[model samples]
Target chain A: MKRALTKRIVIDGVLTAMALAIWVVEAQIPLPLPVPGIKLGLANVVTLFAMFALGPLDAGVILLVRIGLGSVFGGGLTAFLFSLAGGALCYLLCLLLRLVVKDKQIWVLGALGAIAHNAAQIGVAIALTRTTGLVVYLPVLVAAGVITGTLTGLAAQASYLALKRTTLLSRLKGGASLPKEPDDVAGEEDETEKKNQK
Target chain B: MKTWVWVVIVAVILAVSLTVGVVLLTRQPQGNVAYVYVDGELVYQVDLSKVDQPYLYTVNTPYGTNVLEIAKDSIRIADADCPHKECVEQGRLKGSPLVCLPHRLVVKIAEDDADSVSR
Candidate 1:
């Protein structure tokens, strides 16, 4: 049991590191639209994956660490506020999404989470700038959010599916015996995911 | 019901937003008063139609400074100390706020009555 606990900590730490790297790299890319607060949100793929594969707590940790470190590395206090508000909004919605959809439909989680993130960001921008004219950008921002969210969601789904094939996940259950076949793992997921929803 | 179905619904919503955004972007802006804001406080307001000659106004903040070029019927960021210079590249503001996230600066156009409501 102790070994399993250690392994989970190690995995969460690694996921946090991975998320930070992705966030910093994505910030370097020049956006085509020249729009503020719009990006592919590639780092969210890791957060979404961790949310589904590990649990909400692990996902929240990874997200907080990434945003806290990301802003220090790439932005200032104002940018940090925006990221915090957006990330918190996204995570809250993702948690509620667990009840509405099955594991196979992570795309829904991604799209909805992205939309929520953008909405919160817009609210922050408007508040910080004291200009209601920023609302003019909402439609395009929402459009971008949906497209990027769906893309990242699909990527997270692929990673989740691929990870399930390995015995690494089974180690979480007190390092139990590995499932011998792919079918065995798939069948096991059907049961655990249902329990996870509640 | 299926994953693809969810994707379709999101796509449709995206399409509607895109259409609306494009329309808004292309529409002509009617406001003559341009307001510049920093960290949620109104700093400057100019009537574009009243400017007889083009001028540069520099706004200094703890984050950075942005030089705004004001002219008849239009205003833009002539220069900025922010890293990306996105505000400068934004060219001119017609309707949407020219936002500089790095410097926490925003310049936008609004009607006369809009000013009282926001303040």
Candidate 2:
């Protein structure tokens, strides 16, 4: 039992590092548009994968660590607040989505998550600035969010499918021995079989 | 559900937002007053309709300084020390506000006395 706990921590730590790296690197790239709070949001791919494969709780830990560390590394207090609001909204949306979305439709979750994240960030921006004029950016932000969210969501779905069959994940599941069978993410081999038959 | 269903939903959302964005971006600003803000504090309010001559105003913030060009009917960032130059590129204010995130500077158009007066 102790071993499993240790393994889970190590994995979550590794994933958080991965997310932070992506966040920092992506920040360095010049945005194509002039809009603030708009980006590819590549770090969210890891968040979505962790949420789906490991669990929401695991994903939450990784997300919090990533946002906290990310702000220290590449942002300030204001940026941290924006990220926290955005990340929390995205995480909560994912938890709600898990109940309805099928494994094959993970991309939908990604798109919606992106939109929700952007909306929450904009809310923070409005509150901090105390300006209703910033609300004018909403339409553009919403459009951008849908596009970027779809990309990240598809990326997460692809990663989830690829990692599902890896011996590492199997070991994480059966070896660490969580007796894992959530109604949301069970029957992996069966899913593969169904895919193959189709 | 079919993957197409998700695609359709996203498509509809994208279409709607895009239309709204275009409308907002292209619409003319209705009011005469333009408010300048730095770090969320109101610094200056210019009544564009009242200005007979074009002028340049400089806003100095801890983050950086931005030069704004104010004209009879329009306001724009003429120059900025920020890296991206996005504020400068944003051109004149139409319906949307001009924002320089790095410098925490914003220029917004107000339509009525009440709008700028409330702050």
Candidate 3:
């Protein structure tokens, strides 16, 4: 049991490091859109993957760490607040959506989570700037969210599927035995394992 | 739910938002008055139509500095000290306001009303 606990902590640490790296790199790449509160949100791919593969608790820990550290390394207090709100909202939505969304439908979580993230960021922006006129950016932000969210979602879904086929994920999950087949039964077994972990 | 249902729903949302966003982007402002606010407080106002020659306007807030290029009937953020410089890249003011989120700076064009009060 202690070994399982240690392994879980190690895996969470690795995932958090991966997420922070992705976020810092993504920040370096300037987006073409001049609109504020819009980006590719590639780190979301890691969050989604962690949530679906390792369950909500691990995912939440990874997300919070990434957001907290990402802000500290780059943006200051205001950026920290914005990311906190957005990241919290996105995590909550994904947690709720996971029950209804199947393995292949992880992209739905990505798209919806992205929308929630952008909307929450805009809310923060409105309150900070005290400018209701900022609502004018909603439609554009939503459009950008949908496009970027789906892209990241698809990436996560592909990663999840590819990794599930190998023993890598099982090893990460503290050497818990995972079914090797890539079929509906294998998916069901994974779900049962997740339920047991919960 | 079927995968197709999710696809259709996302597609519809994308289409609607894109169309509305485009319309808003393409629409022209009805007035020549620009109001600049820092942390929700009105700091400056400019009558763009009255300016014959372009000039530079600078605003310094607790967050950073933003340099605006005010021209005849148009205003744009020429530069800013913010990390992304998104406000500067936003170019000219149209129907939408130029927002520098990090600095809490907002520049918006107001409607032309002969007797409108500025609060």
Candidate 4:
């Protein structure tokens, strides 16, 4: 019991590290928005992946670590405050949305997370700017969020699937491979996917 | 996948249409008016609608302070004992005056339809 819990703690720590690394890379890209508060929210894919690969608790930790490290690397005090407010709200929204979706198709949840993150950031910007005109940009930002989130979700889903095919995910899920093969799960997924393809 | 494509297409269309609408709706940009107050009294006013070409002018606030002007319409702080330069960005009345909020200084364009926001 203690051993399994320790393994989870370690895996979660590694996942958080991976999330921060991805965030650092994405920060280099300078995608401008018409308004001040919108961005692609690329790091969210890592959170969605972590949520499925591990659990929501692990995902939340990864998000906080990435946000903290990302802000420290690029932004100053004011940016940190804004990111904290926005990132916390985004994570909470994602957690709430996660209940509806199964682990297989978590991208929809990712889309919602992306939109929520932008909304939270815009809310913080409005508070600081005290300008209602800035609110007009929210719809456009939400629209942008949907695209980026979907892409991130697609990437995450692909990675999750690929990892599952190997012995790695099986070992992670259970200490040892079960007597009977768990190939049926993948087979079932493929059958449904084929129908969708048609 | 079909739904996703439609979503992206709609987002693109909406963003482009809204931006174009804002552009079409905006009237030609115009300069601002300059008002001066002294001893808590209305001392003078300058309607810059007729003023053309780049110019700057210096004026005093109620606090007996002199602000600087760079050109016909550009202004800056020649000198200000005020702790914050929030007003410094307000430079010249190309549109608005140097606004010192703590000092209650408003250097802004007075729109013709200031009452009506909708075009």
Kindly list the per-residue Cα lDDT of model 4 for residues B3-113, writing each as its tens digit: 465456545745664565354324332544554433223444555555566454556664436565543433454555454343454334432223343333434333444
TM-score for chain B considered on its own, for each of the candidates: 0.87, 0.89, 0.91, 0.42
State TM-scores per candidate: 0.85, 0.82, 0.89, 0.60
lDDT tens digits, residues A1-198, model 2?
A: 786787678768867887898888887766655466676777898899888878899999999999999888966776788789989998999899888888878888888898899888888777766676788788888898888888888878877777776654675554455545543233553364224222
Q: Which stretches of candidate 4 lie over 4 Å from their true place?
A: A173-198, B1-119
Report the number of the highest-DockQ candidate.
3
Show pairs that collide, candidate 4. Answer: B54-B72, B54-B73, B55-B71, B55-B72, B55-B73, B56-B71, B56-B72, B75-B92, B97-B107
Interface RMSD of candidate 2?
Answer: 2.2
**Candidate 1 wrongly placed segments (more than 4 Å):** A172-198, B112-119
| Number of clashes recorded per candidate | 0, 0, 0, 9
Q: Which regions of candidate 3 are displaced past 4 Å? A: A174-198, B114-119
lDDT of 4 at B73: 37
lDDT per model, in order?
0.79, 0.80, 0.84, 0.57
Local distance difference test, candidate 2: 0.80
Question: Which of the two candidates, 2 or 4, achieves a greater DockQ against the reference?
Answer: 2
What TM-score does model 3 score on chain A?
Answer: 0.85
lDDT score, candidate 4, position A175: 42
Q: How high is the DockQ of candidate 4?
A: 0.07
- TM (chain A), candidate 1: 0.84
TM-score result, candidate 1: 0.85
Using DockQ as the yardstick, the better of models 3 and 4 is 3
